[model samples]
Target chain A: MDRNIAGVTIQVNEEGYLTNFAQWNTAIGDALAAEADLALTPRHWEVLNYLQTEFKNDSPLSIRKIGKSGVVDIKEFYQLFPTAPLKTASKIAGIPKPASCI
Target chain B: MKRILILGAGTAGTMMANHLHKELSPNQWEIDIIDEQEEHYYQPGYLFLPFDIYEPEDIIKPIRDFIPHGVNLLIEKIDRIVPREQYVQMENGDRLRYDILIIATGTKIAPEETEGMQGEEWKKSVFDFYTFNGSLDLRNKLREWQGGRLVVHVTEMPIKCPVAPLEFAFLADSYFKNKHIRDKVEITYVTPLSGAFTKPKATTALQHLLDEKHIHVETDFAIERVDNENKMIVDYGGREIPFDLLVTVPTNKGDDLIARSGLGDDLNFVPTDKGTLQSKAWQNIFVLGDATNIAASKAVSVAHFEAEILTENIKRFIAGEPLNAEFDGHANCFVETGNGKALLIDFNYTHEPVEGTFPLPGVGPLRLLKESRLNHMGKLAFRWIYWNMLLKGTHIPFVSTHMQEAGKEFA
Candidate 1:
């Protein structure tokens, strides 16, 4: 089903992750972060941008990579996305889910 | 000639087929094994399914492939066993008589025993990964679930692969972090035990892991019912913990056929001599694995160890000699702590997990009661060893069924 974010119909899966990256916008990001009960922070966006950029570059994301990404260290990475960093960051960043996630 | 009939072609039964057939002369012993299911699942792999660590194709294999060629593999449901007469009545109406019976029929997940657990939310919100189909269903459900209150619970103890629930919680912690929804989902572990594990020393070590992962634990909570409508589980004390998704290990009990045969206790567990694995009620009947009321943990490794001791005693029983072998209830398991790391624990009926090196004294390998990458590799590599080495009843070099004291530290 599609969700309305800022009066725009955005594609999403049953889990509320954006199905199409192109359909993602700031309004959708706001809505996703709101659903996660997390307020958008500059540090959170740094990791989100790193995840999004890595997805665009066709590079795989891992805890080790994000920990060394300079934007957020391993401890801070967990702090930003305490549940799951790559999957949550990618979803909020309008990227596909990682393969390693079970 | 004597007939040896083994029930349930699971890990224990399969091992027995090879172990006994090699020892008992073909001219003197005719062995037969029966199981309803065509597929044999590596039960440990079930713990990884929901987390997407292992796939269905990776764990399941045909039972016929595992059963030794000399033994007759009967793929039929058992109707009932006439224990006194020493014969099992097959559902297809065959009365197979046995001179000696080995009941290796393993325990099963009894979800129906728990009230409201299988309500409207069953396979929807409430899930179990104990069974083959249940694991596959849970895999799909977990993939679609964004993030919410993820509760990993155990209805009671004596569940197969006792460490599996903790492994699930650890993998779930890693899975969510990789997903970047770690904060979005709240992971809690609920068990009837007072601590993270049964053993005291291991409990302290594992409890630290739980606390490290920020996974809240609800201890000693005897569940009354699952309030599916309200998305909460109600304990007998009227305590309720709400969950967006409930992954539970329901009450595990032995096969009902044991109960029907009047050879089992109230929970359908066959009471057996802990040392000999021989059935207490009948001289000719023996039991092992999760089906037996042994003091050991219900683990595949325990079954493998029991198979060794039982095989030795079975030979003695056949030769009109005394059964002298003993099983010390030795069990070892790799506790996954996520992040491509795991902890190894080795213990027996008397010993809890202790800090030390394993197998070789002062050898620089395989640390115990502590996390290491080598232990993680060992955990992953065990699946191969389980099928090829363990099932073949081939003795693992330097590894004994009994727990050793050489390299272990008491403190």
Candidate 2:
């Protein structure tokens, strides 16, 4: 899968699961981690895990609808994730290297 | 002595003319306003015209009557603004020189921008409320016509008063209901935004309201063209929404004079410092209201808030004092939601519409993000305030230029 957003390139599978994690070394992930300015929390991790599982199941979750499904309020979910949860989690998971992250 | 030239004697321009006329003395400064049309329209009253709440005669007044005696009122089309030469050329091959220029040239519907929109259906099956003529034409059509699929559409974002489209939809629901044809007519709202509003929180609340009213919503629909022959609006994604009566807020663009002058953006809006209202192209030139390429909604209330800040800055510029860079994207809107109730929304650049009380926070006569009868009354009362106090440059009591955080109890 070829994914490009705001001039960044990413190659992944149909489920957006990465076949090549080696394409993005730890240095880029560490750099992205520094730039995001996010404090890693269990709740944030739970969302990332949920999104990864959803993507693996060949279904992309609607961030807003998911929020309204009782996990969190839509506003709080946005506060947690300004960009899309899938895109942000993809960066953290190092599944497909975000062009911006790289 | 300074020669100040203002373009378009519409709501924003008229208010600014009244403001400068009151602020500056005749001996110290000379003011001139240029507009092609002689009639001044009460735009807000257009919403009520279709329902016979406001007479067409009541909404119009002579432009010259409102302009003060000392100011030069040139009822002519502007050819172009030659800012480098500090003058604006008129259609009659005459030039009016200026020491300072204020651009309050507001926006209006541009139907030609959309494909097939201005064709056979225009003003017959289709109408717009932005213009006085369109409203009157729609009124005549709605009077004798039976109810059908009434589609209230917004062509794109940054249209004047975002809530007005929703208000029209709500009012249509009530109008058909009153006429005993509520069951016959189906109301639908089509917006380009992801939800009902551009803001996230307000979108959820307004989406809920839309559901409660049984109004169907088609979101994220970028209108490619109006398929007039098929009686449907075709989106780029091939989504065809049928409508019997298409009331659309056509693409709103700045005055043609801006495009002719070659000083405006792709949409013909002048680029200005978002906070200062100062023109990016020239130091002496300033812009206000819908003419600027600002992120805020192009509404009269925003213009009113911006006028306060811009007036102060202009005074400073005249005095050789440092300009004050302080204009929050303050926009306040009253959303009429049928059944004698309305919702008030107060927001700026960063803040979205939150559930709270406005004007006095906890003791608000108006509630933000919630429907109330008092808000409806306030919406009705504004037309009186607009003509009497607002246009006269008198500060409205209790309504501040900036959004006050005092009274609001955050959700």
Candidate 3:
């Protein structure tokens, strides 16, 4: 699926997560965050950068991992994204939602 | 003779011992399995123990009962694994070298990972069914207790038998209703995931069941601490769910031996090649089951399937042949949905469980992703197979090592 974010066409999944990380930019991230009713601050960008780094390295993301990443604590991460922090942060950061192996 | 050392005589290690003992010539190769414990536990039975459906004796047997006669069984504690030197250091100051090493020291629930989980209210108001003692204790607790708020929770993701907590909630509903206290008891399921399960199709089916059973669900809750004083679990987002009885699957981690040996990740799970089941750090060492940091579900079915592939890979390594990357993360599980019915699901790395016929495909005696009494019977019958056939590395009839796409509804 494609969505116009920040005046740019970006590929996204049904859940509104960016499918292609290569096409992600700050403007698109701002727009995605805005859609979720979040205003991205510098601290939010730090956590977003950490999530993107972990995604690029092919490391699985988890709330526990994010808590231990030294970038932000889990409480602040939750407060920043407000709901489903990992899912929302992944969307704003242009990555896939962290899935649990079932 | 060349030596093959297997760590932990649990499900995966026991099956590997049997498979290798039959496959490798005894004259050319020797196999040894080690574990500190004496009893072989039927881990799945832990689910029924809290419901008083299975007796303690039914799930436990001497570990020696499953070990093959020709294979060596060592009841000794391992201090550490010296992977670079291809040897293991025993706690008693004995060092054993191996030509090949298989680590199946499975994962265990660590209640201490969360603050206040193991505190003053540890086994009193709070409990876990992931262990034999925990389940037995909970059984006793549920026997005499009047109904109140019952919270079945998962502290984090990637826990073993991921559906067990939900199953616990469902069973509690039936249990309370049977006791004629259904109205008095409020059952709530708390999870870290966004829905009733991980996969899309299965989650939809299970969430509907939750609604039908009248079990309240609290999703996307990443717990931070258990407030024992207030009898409430507080999440990172500051959401609090109070409970009279808290049954939580705490953080699951690999054996502490992995940590002491410095061979684990942040959660003490070993890093291994998911396809080959070989340790990424050491070529001679292999890992499977809950110990490895794989994306596969940490379930017995997965270990059963991996045992078949690991046996072949071990043989290839001995013959100087390239290893076969054939393991597809296949797992077949029967989810007990209470009221004497269950749902059977078969899936792999690429496929989420969907509606289909299993084992026999279109002619299945078992249906997939739908509740049925036949599926419940299959789950009960699995106990016999686990002890008699599965541990002996026998291939289950009609069940393939890989997931089949036939008879499945994809779209």
lDDT of each: 0.82, 0.77, 0.90
* Superior by lDDT: candidate 2 or candidate 3: 3
The recovered share of true contacts, given per candidate in order, is 0.00, 0.00, 0.34
RMSD of 1: 20.4
Model 1 spans > 4 angstroms off: A1-102
Residues B80-181, model 1: lDDT tens digits: 888789899998899999999999999999898778999999999999989988999999998888999999998865678777888899999999999888
Which pairs of residues collide in candidate 3?
Answer: none
Ranking by TM-score: 3, 2, 1
For candidate 3, write residues B1-411 as lDDT tens digits: 999999999999999999999999999999999999999999999999989889999999999999999999999999999988989999999999999999999999989889899988889999999999999999999998898999999988678988888888888888888889999999999988776676778776666788888999898888889999999999887889999999999999999899988998878888888789998888899998888888788899999999999999999999999999999989999988999989998888778888888887688878899999999999999999999999999999888888889988888
lDDT string, candidate 2, B232-291, tens digits: 997655678999999999988888889998878656788788888998899999999889
Error of 3 at B95 (Å): 0.5
The global Cα lDDT (0 to 1) of model 1 is: 0.82
Runs in model 3 lying further than 4 Å from the true structure: A1-13, A18-28, A39-42, A56-59, A100-102
Ranking by DockQ: 3, 2, 1
Question: What is the lDDT, from 0 to 100, of the residue A80 in candidate 2?
Answer: 69
